[model samples]
Target: MPVLLYVLAVAVFAQGTSEFVLAGLVPGISADLGVSLAEAGYLTSGFAVGMVVGAPLTAAVGRRLAPRWTLSACLAVFVLAHVSGALTDSFGVLLGTRFVAALANAGFLAVALSTATRVVPAGRRARALSVLLGGTTLALIAGVPAGALLGELWGWRSALWAIAGLSAAALVAVGRLTPPRTSTDHPGSARPRLDLRAELRTLRSPDLLRHLGLGALVNGATFCAFTYLAVTVTDGAGLVPSLVPLVLALFGLGAFAGVSVAGRLADTRGRLLLDVAGPALLAGWIAWAALADSPAAVWVLAPVQGALSFAVGSTLIARSMAAAQGAPTMGGAFSTVALNLGALLGPVLGGASLGTAGTAGPLIVSTALVAVAVGLRLVTARRRSGAPAR
Candidate 1:
């Protein structure tokens, strides 16, 4: 409900754009740097690798600092990295800047996510967190496309400048708006801090690990379809190439809708949302395979599957943070790590099986992954129920 949360979302939008805008710039980068397209593609992978390593590392390193300062510092690093990236002609320098920017992004997101929950009441945590994630969705819809367009028109360096400007603005906003360290968790009580050992124990928790695993599997399934969706739309579904943008936009809109609805329900009705979503997601993928060749089906199903994927994915993130109550920042970091891990692996797995059956292979592979996750959830629940409590 606070404006501060929205400010955090703005910063997220800037970083999220940086995270995705590389896909559009790969060609320009390859030509300008005299590198292969394959090498240019590694810039994106470098960012992902940085996110995975930086999230937990930064969270641990900044644990003693106030959330506001930690966030501001991260944003400063991000802005500087983008600026440096724009100025660099050397491909290696640009790649290093992306990695540095990703590190800052990982740290900011972890702290911001943790900060979002603490600034709100218990019952509103899910909704609050959703607002933060909404920025990422917006990036998918507006920021990435806009950046890509800028690259297309003005060269890729112009897009990097835009990101730097956006990040600089967000950095100023974060510094001005985020709550100071002295704010109390309750009336007449000092703000609570984590015990280092207890935080480590919570990080190692079985419950938290399961939540992370579920998130990773579900995200993997969702992304496997997403990575191949454009080709599927044009080559498999017989749609024209131009319509690919529309289909992708529709998916982004559906994703925003899913996050909005799930945020409202996930706090109290988490189980209900997941219960309904799991089967629907499984069915959604199966049905997509059955109808993947139809143009009409592609138009309708892109958004539907997008909604299902994000609804479950966002809910898992919220629940995972809940499971790590004693260490919110680290939990947030782990959530980032989990989702990125899936984003990385799912495409690899899907690509490996791509030639077997056209678009349907990805659909089938994604379906199998989700099926494994749903079955694992059921099994985990069964074991927990059977176990005798102390």
Candidate 2:
């Protein structure tokens, strides 16, 4: 584990917190901005959209720049977006800030992942990637909870202010830690030309595309349950509102544990994980839906579900990067887009089930989504082995 990976994780912590903490501040924002809660919720959706758009665009524009500089620029922009968001009086301006901040977040993550793998030994690439992703799971456990508390105590703007300050500190750390130049940045000294045409061609691989789609499905299923987890915890389990954070904490802890364990195995046992995780998740989600009425079961299963979700999610991403090894940086963008696309869709499908299905709706949806992923994986595997597709 390189020290630089931790530094990047810290930066990711600051940015990732921004992605989730908005839910806690929705009430404050809606009241302050004179908008409906539905409207304020769009802030999160806007951020997701921005991330999907920004990853590839930012990667292409910064392809020539050293990653140290790219990461720094991203954190700087992230800081600026938060500062702007904190000071804004208009809801429209705030929405725009969310979009801008997500762009920064997307670019930072894509570059940070690529850089982490490059700096580490090849054998540890998966572990290195997980360490970077740990920051995200950590954000869920500690950072978002803290930010929501800040919003509760001081107001929504205060949460943004805290995020901005935290992000600024991370910016300084990134600037200090990452290498200022790679060989690619060197002028006229055996700089391998990365032909855009060649890279684009690599994206067309069926295997790579399958990995991307599978990654999306895994993420979609995770988000399907996760987005509405609070509802399930509160309304279904009959837990007090205050306990929601504790449940979320359990989920995050499980996610962190999952990522750590999966990271270590992703390089060596990735195939095994891929083969096993889907069925595990399918069972987990089905059990979750069946047991939604049991408070004890819900409590016990939160961590289990979290662990399964991140393990499978991380494995799929590792596989995607492995497949996209031809253009590793662009691979980062593709992975980000796939994962965020899932993030965006998961909530929509889950939300749809809420009206008629109640608390179990999202869980059932989650089960179905992962089932599709499992089927796809099996089909793709058979095809690769020269078996006819079912």
Candidate 3:
């Protein structure tokens, strides 16, 4: 694997940490900013909205730029946004900064995934992609927890400052490691036609659409449950408030394990089954979690559910990239959008479920959604195999 892959991975790690660490720091931020907890929660929502808007927009704009340069520019934007977020006094300004930061993050991820696959040998491409993507999972496992600890000790602003520093390191690494852009065409050739129409045509395939839909559904369901997981563990399970961050950290650790295992399994066994099976298992785990009343059960079940849900990341991403044919960037961008959509909807749904059906309703709905995703995957897989061989 190229050393550049590792550099890009660092960039991803920084972005992931910045995006998710907020969850652990929400209460601190609310207290420091003099905002209500509900308002502080909008930071997560703002980031999600930015990701959804940025993916396609960045892809469209960066079509003409070299992939390396595009990535570098995105990282620069990310760093600036983080700095702004760290320094801002007003809550509204902080939210705007976070949203822009998320936009840069989404674009960086989409471009980085495309570049990783392109740089590696075809035989090792999936593994290469896994290595790059694993950085984000690692951040979830380690970075968020550490940030929470820092927030508790110093303040939430300190956590944001730390993220900004990390982003700076990532920017420098990316600039040094990535190679100059090379054209797919003849030397000094005019840029190839981007063909937005052709790209849209790719989405018209029934199999591709089904895969995308499955991606969206699985993510939406998973996020819905996960967004409010910390709250559930604290409020419903009756765990001490101080322990919530540690539990969330453990969840991140489970996610890291899940992502690593899932990547290898998808590369070897095929992604479709892994996609369905991971979510199905996650649903069962969530149900178990819902039924448990003890603190021990909460600890055990949270990690289990985290493992099952996150394990499917690589599989789902690889599936979308494969189904996209040659347009890996657009496919990746769309997948990012799906993920953000899930992030946006998950907390809202979970909160509503908590209000309406009490603690168990969200998990029950999540289980049903995962089951539906599994059925959809089965039908899609059979249809693909039954079709004329490509």
Candidate 4:
């Protein structure tokens, strides 16, 4: 992999940490802002909404700019947003700042993925994309936990300041390491004309939309279990409250590990990886729901589910990019859009399941969602093989 791709991952790490660390700081924020916990939860939802709106809009706008410059501008905005968020007194101001930060984050990721595809060879594109996305998974594993500790030690504002500082460093590294904007285009040509109507047309494929839908289903199911994983571990698995964070970290570690393995497989054996992981995800969820009462089984199930889910995600991303080969930026942006849409729906469904069907209900919902994805994948395979549709 190119060294600059890793630098892009660092930038992603800063943004990913900023986006997710809020989960751990909700209590601190609610206490400080004098808002109810439910109200403070809007901050998270607001970020997801921003990502959904920002992805395509940013892709369209950034299409006119050089990829590195677009990435740089987004990182600058991200840093400033955090600085403002850290200093804001009003909850509304903080929420607005988060929305702005998410816009920049969405732009950064979309450009970064598109740029990685351009710089790497055809065969290694998926691996390159995976290395860039690995930063987000690593943030889930390490950054969120550390931010939670910092929030406990010095308050939530401290976490925002730390994120801003890291973003600034990433901004500097991006400027130093990434190739110039002109390098992304032809040897001596102006930035390509960004025809909005033409670009939008590229994303209108039924097949592409189906795959994107599959991605949303996969993400939604994972988050359905994850949204209430803490409760499930404590009440269902009989683990102590103190062990919850450890188990959640285990899930993140599983995601990081899975992404790493999937990154390699995507480059060399993508079809085989997809074939195995989709069914494995359904099986993992089945075991999770069936063995919810066993602490040991829960420990094993949590990471397996996480790994299989993320491995499937990496493959889908690569597929989406390939499917939208005519407009790479839009393709990359759509992946972000799909994942955020899933994030938004997952919590709602999970909360409902928890309220009505008890702790294991979310697990069952997740299993069913992954099963849908499995069925879709099989249909895609059959279509490719010229076999009759089921």
Candidate 5:
């Protein structure tokens, strides 16, 4: 991997922190802003909404600019938005800032992923991509916890200030490290360009649609359980409030491990890895739903579930890009969009299930989603292997 890959990861870390730190700060924000917990929760969903909208919009708009310039500009916006979020007095202002910040974040991630694929050798694409995406897992492990600690010590606003500082540093690094446009990674290729019609045309492809759906389902399965993990662990598993952080850390560790394994298998064993991972994910969720009442069972199961959950990131993105045909940047954008869509949908569906079926409801719903995804993959694999479609 190139040094620039790690720099991009740093940018992702800052953005990912801003995206999720709200998870731990909802209570603080609610108290400080004189809002209900549900209102504070909208800060997170608002970011997801921005991500879903901004990915394709930014990809279309920025396609004409050089990747370095586009990425730097996005980071600048990200930094400004974070600072604004820190200084805002009203909950509405904070929500608006989060939305703008997510727009920048989505743009940055799309451009970064496309550039990562361009910079590395074809054989190392998966590893390079993993290195770039690893920032999200690392943020989950370190950034969120750190932000929570900062909020506890100071105030919720302090967390935003810290993220702004981090984003500023990433901006400087991006400006210094990203490659120039003149050295376009694809030899003999035209400058990046996309129009609304072109984007619409690309979306018409069934294969791309399938890949996007797969990405969405894969992510939805993970997040359905994850969105309500803190509540589930406390209420269903009988853990104390203090133990919540431990379970979260365990999940993060598991995600990091999953990304590590994905980097190794994505290139050589894409199908096989998913073949195994998809079912493992289903099994893990089923186990969680069945045994959630047992704290001992949850202690052993959470990390394994977390690990299997994210095992598809690199492979899924690569597959989606393959289906993209000519529009690689848009492909990357759609990948982000699909994941955000799942993130948004997961909580809604999980919340509904919880209301109907109690604490284990989310786990069961997540399991069903993954099972459908796995079934899709099985059918696709069979078709590729010359087996008749049933």
Candidate 6:
């Protein structure tokens, strides 16, 4: 793998830590700001909203710039946003900073994934992409736990400061390590006939839509359960407050392992079977978690859930890149945007269920969504086979 993969992975790790650290520190943030837990939840929702809007917006703005420069600039912005988040005392300012940070983050990941594919040999593309995305797992394994510990010791603000420092390190790494620009017209070259109409035309392909729907379903179910993991572990499973981050770290380790294995599987076998199986497995695991009240059970299940939930990232992403035909960048961006959309909706659905039905509701609802998704995948497969030949 190219050394740049490690560089981009570092940037991604920083971004992922910033994104998820808030969950572990939610109680601290709520207490510090004198806000309710529900309101503090905006931190997660705000970031998702930013990614949803920012992914395409930033991609469009950076279209003319070199991918390397675009990535570096985004990391710099991420550093600034984390600093701003660390310094802000007001809830509104902290939320706004997170949003800004997410904008940069969205652009960084989208461009980095596309560029990773471009820099590697065709056969090694999936592995390169997996290594790049594995940074998120690393963040969960290391950064989030560290941030949570920092929050527990120094305060949530201090945790944000640590994240800022990581972002700064990533900015420097990307600046020094990202390869030089090879084409000003590279984006155009990838999609010479690109336009809103042309993009929409591609969407009309039922096969492509099926694959995208699978991606969304898998992600949505995963995020729904994941968003409230801290709450579930603390309240539902009766774990102590201090141990949540440690469990989360364990979950992250599982995700890292899952992504590694899934990447090779996707490259060797097709993604469709993995797509179908992953969500099914996740649903079962989450259901088991909901019923098991033992802390030991929770500990064992956390990693199992994480592994199953994240197993699809590389496969789904590579599938989308392939489905995009020649427009890898646009395809990469769209796939990410779809994933963000899932993140956005997942929490809302989970939160609503939690409100209406209490602790077990979210997992039950998540399981239902995954089952529906599996059925959709079957229907989608049948439809693809029955469609008139291109």
lDDT of 4 by residue, 1-103 (tens): 8898898998888788888889889999999999999999999988989989888888888787767788889999999999999998999999999899999
Error of 3 at 82 (Å): 1.3
Tell me the whole-model lDDT of each prediction, alpha carbons only. 0.86, 0.86, 0.74, 0.84, 0.83, 0.76
User: Candidates sorted by lDDT, descending order?
Assistant: 2, 1, 4, 5, 6, 3
**Which sections of candidate 2 miss by over 4 Å?**
184-193, 386-390
* Better candidate number, 2 or 4, judged by TM-score: 2
Q: In model 4, where do residues sit more than 4 Å from their true spots?
A: 182-194, 383-390
**What's the lDDT for candidate 1?**
0.86
lDDT of 2 by residue, 5-103 (tens): 998998888888999999889999999989999999999999999999988888778877888888899899999999999998999999999999999
lDDT of 3 by residue, 263-285 (tens): 66665665554745655665565
How does each model score on TM-score?
A: 0.95, 0.96, 0.90, 0.94, 0.95, 0.89
Segments of candidate 6 deviating more than 4 angstroms:
182-201, 272-276, 279-283, 286-290, 294-297, 386-390
- Report the error of model 5 at residue 164, Å: 0.8
Better candidate number, 5 or 6, judged by TM-score: 5
Give lDDT for model 4: 0.84
Each candidate: how many clashes? 0, 0, 1, 0, 0, 0
Higher-TM-score candidate of 2 and 3: 2
Evaluate residue 167 in candidate 2 and report its C-alpha lDDT on the 0 to 100 scale.
82
RMSD of each: 2.3, 2.5, 3.1, 2.3, 2.1, 3.2
Q: What is the alpha-carbon lDDT for the whole of candidate 3?
A: 0.74
Global Cα lDDT for candidate 2: 0.86
Angstrom error at residue 332, model 4 = 1.1
Q: List, residue by residue over 313-333, the lDDT tens digit for candidate 5.
A: 557877676666457667678
Q: Over 4 Å off in model 5, which ranges?
A: 182-196, 382-390
